[model samples]
Target chain A: MSADAGTDADAGADVGAYADTETGADTDADANTAPDATATAAAAATAPAGTPPDATPWRRLHPLSLLVTAQLLAGAAFGAGVPVGAGLAAHIPFRAAVAWVLAGSALLLAGGLALDVLRLRHTRYRVGAERVELRTGVLFTTRRSLPRDRIRSVDLTAHPLLRLLGLVKVRIGTGDQTAGGESPLQLSPVRRAEGESLRRELLRRAGPAAGGSTEGRLAALVPRWIRYAPLSFLTPLLAMTGWGAVMQVSQWFGAEETVVDLVRDTFSPLPAGWTVLALTLLFLSAGVVGSFGTWAEMWWNYRLEREPDGTLRVRRGLLTTRSISLEEARLRGVDVVEPLGVRLSGAARVDAVATGLSRRDSEENDLSTLLPAAPRAVADEVAARVLRAPVALTRPELAPHPRAALARRLRWSLGAALVPVAVLLLLAAALSVRGLAYAGAATAAVLLPAAALLARDAYRSLGHGLAGPYLVVRSGTLRRSTVALRRDGVVGWTVRQSLFQRRAGLVTLRATTAAGAQAYAAYDVGEAQGLRFAEEAVPELLAPFLVPDDGAVEQPAERTCPDRWSPVRT
Target chain B: MQVVGIDREGRNRGPGPAGLRLRPPHHRVDRRAVAWWRTRLLLAAAVPAGVLAVLGALLGPARFWLLVAGAGVAAAGLAAGLGLPAWYYRVHRWEVTDDAVYVRTGYFWVDSRIAPMSRIQTVDTERGPLQRAFGLAAVTVTTASAKGALRIEALDHEEAAELAEQLALATQKTPGDAT
Candidate 1:
């Protein structure tokens, strides 16, 4: 490709290098493991007849030894302690047990060393037209075959040692294991160049995965995703504000007399206002730090790439770098998450949920984060690339409506302060006006402003959009959440015309995806549209997986469920 | 031959296309039977948790159940979870092919995984007391993933090691497949 074409492709996005090549030198450290003389000889003999005699063999995946050795050693240490304690506490002679323990340790160590060499020598990986096959084992050799098309996600990770060796490990996560068994295929101690090449092959094998770069001009407004690390203070900031208000309310009402008594014990010369200011500063400082952790926990190094097969490749990491590739067809939906900062500054974070991934579970949420830095338009471009559809985000469907949002906040604040107000009123009836003063101050400042902000933020954060097979619902004030379910992918969608939503002309839409189900959120859209979207998403995503009912006899209503295993299978 | 984990049949299989296949005569296991057993084993892995939950609920009222259940589940879960790893050893089977490796493990959750020659990173073997008693060994093959590489287990140790050696060499023998 010419520079002009490359420039056009990159446009506003940063495209420093089509590929990072300097890391090749760094990957050499781990490549220097003890060479296998046997493998070398065989490699020479096995050379194809027409090939040059001195052709260097492709680098074998470094066998996992020192790492496995460390694991076995640690496990053996526990074994050592148990037997020593047995010998000391019980009458049994520790000598035999200790010898056994030592022997076991030796075996484990040997296994580690042997496996390392074996890993280097045995398995050969080949990505064929239809699938990937792994063959290796001694007498009863084993081979595993996976259709490239069926892979859900190709996850990449690197331990500190692996990282030091400039090697990263990759896991092919297929949502099949019930016990959450570790993935069965891995290539550790891999050079970055080769690893990326394998990744490209998987994407090409699956279909092109595209995301992020399509925003045409949106890269200028949003940070160049690569130029950025990531900024996340939202979750923790929300936590602090909410928790701080709770602490303030507790101190003012529940522990008032005790605090008053303690204050009365202080030096008589100290002024009340000075004491309040000092306490406020201390409390706010703690709250700030507390909230920071919440945001820091989720912040990660995120980079989004457009794969050749039109899938979105998201790579993110904190300690252990992880990579997940999502096909546009696999995406449920897409939405631009706009905070107050985004709405004001024309910068927004884009997020989406793909099939079989859940963001509700905090564990899944860490893995589910798709894009964190792209601008609203850039996100729209990514939606086109990754989702293969473009959506123009509409004005948010604010909860309680915009006008009612303030009233809802006011009503909630009043309802919350009622008990304290009643107690103050009762106390006033018995002749103490100070309690009433405290209640009034607390209600006016903390409760009212806090409630109002929350309601407003909640309203601002809500949105819904429809683009082809996708039904996108956007919500959450800080950790902006957007759930996209492909209309075709839905297994079963339920439309609930409850007394409240039906009467209000609103409806709840719930749909089940490959992994589990998602429910209707509080969005201002009509139930008719929600139901319509569900109808679309059903055949869109589920067409491939759902085994059609081919005229099987329907059992009686009273019959116990025929298949006990359907839950996991489904 | 299919009933036993031992690929004792001298006609071992290697990966290849179904008919234009240069595949080494491979050992094909009873996948359905393996799946049936693996499902039970995976459930057994979680037996301790279920027992702890049931016991805790039965012994304590709602208030203390959470605490009791938590402790009981932790203990039972750890104790009973050996079913997964154990059954994994029992049912894990592999069939080598001309171009790639095929691994099938677990009784119920059958993993019919194929790692091609290009993508394979490592392969290793192990022998423990149980394997020693059975005169069997374990082989693990590693491939790259997002987090770390995955190590697919359940191989006939010595053979798997030798096979791995064979693969490492054949990887060079083949062209274009090695990325």
Candidate 2:
């Protein structure tokens, strides 16, 4: 691997200063390298701006990380049964076997460390004033750069192992979602402070003006907020996880029957109904405690603050902390999410409707969650502040869809419930299973009411209206969301009417935007009313289709089609 | 029990808006689109019908009536395939103005859309294997919209290309004011 950044002379000169710092080869050296790395950074900082682009010295990850990687690889090798398999094949004696295993592991660790050192030597990154560039790979080299101006987010994350080593990974992204490969610049296992500086440097937008009181703290971590955490759907999930863990561990001990017998014995004295009720209560309590612990671990020192550099930053976590920075300028609006149980407690969470947060795979998408579960009023207050509006649009009562929408929901839900009933009836007829008949009756009795209730809730959730510069749309029963989207942010409108919707005189109007999930819908609204709403939301976009609305017409059927869809008569 | 409104020339209209009747869409696709759709639809239906006919015949005399029904379905499918495309062609119309693209399509459940030019992300021409054989192509216009991309199909290859270029120009004129 070339230590020489020789191909680019100016960049090469900058890279030379880091050679001394990168050679911290021992574990003790690893602990001491934090100050040395910072000193090297300071010494190299004297390079002039005229040097080809914003090239700072090329630096590698901290040396301690190499040890961590080596340890992990050695563990993985053992887990793969490599050492045992090889030892057994060699027919090694008992005492010699232990030595052989130790020697083999030591050799594996040495090889892994040596390769990691080579990897570190080959990997070089420079944080330029305008761009952050990374060049890596020994066999297949890759040189990638991301413009600082395009940098959307800078996130810091540390898992348990890295946290133990006082190291964290820094991920810098350009906010472009469609890039297929490993496009983001990742600086793995940097000293905790180094990670902070990298985040500060990359996110520093222009120089912070002296004597400016631009910083505003939106919300700080409060212990009481943890109370709302247990109310989330995670509670039930965590309870199930606990039960599954108990079952799994017992099976591992080959005493699964004993565990099951113990559980059955505990509940044997109770009536059937009381048993179910008691079990449910037990699970709920367990779930509440479990979710609360998880919440604390995730958000121990939670803080949402606005930096002077036009960024909304969230810093939190107890064991493995994270600092996620979202550029304020890219923020479109906010969505106040209220899940059913949380809503009952009058609590909600605030999510930013910003560009570049559409990552579907990881919890990194939660980077835009400005506020954790809190009081509905507080969530609204924070949302309003984030969007810089007078008040949150979601607070307002949304205009309801027509009655036909409710009927449609009922029909759909009932149809879904009927499928199981139909199947159970068919099964009963074929096998003369009398129990199936009772089960079918029970299913219908329970499902029909539940479906009807959900349908009603769904109907109640549908609404859309404008709140200042924001267009507010609320929908969904299971995961009810009220989004305050910037009117200017909306790029277009898509009006759809299925055959059923048309017959019911309803249209689902969608406002397409680049922010959030790209579209927000006002489902099953009165057709003309929806059109007028769309026209009002963005006049330039939907005006031509309005048909003037003047009081004069020869044909009524043509009026129903709207100007855009009405067939042109020659 | 009845409501009447006076029209412009003093004619009484019953329980409806006195004005605002829209003019019917005038434009249609390329003439060859009808033939293209007919051939595709016929093949799609014919294959399924042939499979069903074979399956029914294999079931022997006890299910001889099923074979007859399968043959009857095949004939009906063939008839629909030959005629439905022409009817669909009459309903399928698209018109582009300075501001938006209006598409009226679908035979059973007619759907129409007015996609604004300002929101268009990219416009491209697509030629599937079969479309290429017919010397026809489809113009797809996409926005960041969740409805996915909208395709204007069965146009001459050159015409589709031209339409895509025009749409692209429109998008450039109204570039997204976002990151």
Which candidate achieves the best DockQ against the true structure? 2
lDDT by residue for model 1 over A1-570, one digit each (tens)? 122454334321211120111122113422323111112222323433342221212235655535645665667766565544454444446676666666766776777667666655555555655445454454334444455655556666665556666677776543332213324456655665667777777766555244334432222222244222223344345546765665565453355566556656763466889878876665556555554443333345556765556566666555556666655555555545555544445555565555445323315554554555555566656555545454443222322222333344356556775656566667766777776767656765666566666666665555554555555566666445555555444333333333444334443444433432234343433433343333344433212222222223322122123221111211
Q: Can you list each candidate's DockQ? A: 0.02, 0.22
True contacts kept of each: 0.00, 0.21
Off by over 4 Å in 2: A1-55, A70-114, A206-215, A246-282, A361-365, A421-442, A548-570, B1-26, B45-91, B105-111, B146-148, B175-179
User: lDDT tens digits, residues A1-570, model 2?
Assistant: 235555456446444433332332222432211111222334444534333433366677877888689769877767544536444545766667666666877887888888888777767787866456676667665555565766777889887778888899998877665343434678887889988888888777733632244548888877888888887877899999999988866664466899989978999999999999999999999999898888888888899988766778898888878888888766778888888878878888898887656456235546778889889888988888877777766788777777888999999999999999989988998999999988999999999999999999999999888888888899888778899988877766666667898667677888877677777889887666666677777776655555533434423232223233222333
> Against the true structure, whose TM-score is highest?
2
Tell me which residue pairs clash in candidate 2: A54-A128, A552-B19, A553-B18, A553-B19, A566-B24, A566-B25, A567-B24, A567-B25, A568-B24, A568-B25
Badly placed stretches (over 4 Å) of model 1 are A1-61, A64-145, A175-184, A208-302, A315-322, A338-347, A358-366, A373-381, A390-441, A456-472, A476-486, A489-492, A497-506, A511-570, B1-179
Which numbered prediction scores highest in lDDT against the true structure? 2
- Return the TM-score for each candidate structure: 0.45, 0.79
Residue A308 accuracy (lDDT) in model 1 = 54
Q: Assess candidate 1 and give its lDDT.
A: 0.46
